[model samples]
Target: MTDISEVFGFIKDFGFPVVLSWFLLVRMENKLAGLTEVIGELSCNIAAMRGEIPKR
Candidate 1:
């Protein structure tokens, strides 16, 4: 079995890259969320113009 210390050592060695990747992922998630909100609003507007309820 691998020792816990070894795991921690590996993380310590690559922590910066891991943290950077997490930061980038979070930023991407936020941007995608904003884009999703904008798309939802646009869809609602289009549906209103067509006199139909947006698909639930």
Candidate 2:
């Protein structure tokens, strides 16, 4: 079984900044993924208007 103290100790050793940075990175990645999807849709829309094949 895992000990609770071990987990807390690990977090304490690493500090809050590292954890915060990871959190921020994950949030940024999610936002970037959403932006990528929106860009893809916009590109497809433009391609349709131009009557050109949109390279996937």
Among the numbered candidates, top TM-score falls to 2
What shift in Å separates residue 28 of candidate 1 from its native position after superposition? 1.3
Q: What is the C-alpha RMSD of each candidate to the true structure, in Å?
A: 4.8, 5.6
User: What's the lDDT for all of these models?
Assistant: 0.92, 0.91
Report the lDDT of model 2 for residue 1: 78
For candidate 2, write residues 1-47 as lDDT tens digits.
77999999988988787989999999999999999999999989889
lDDT per residue for candidate 1 within 6-29, as digits (tens), equals 999999989989999999999999
Model 1: how far is 46 from its true place, Å? 1.0
Relative to the true structure, candidate 1 reaches a TM of 0.60
| Candidate 1 global Cα RMSD | 4.8
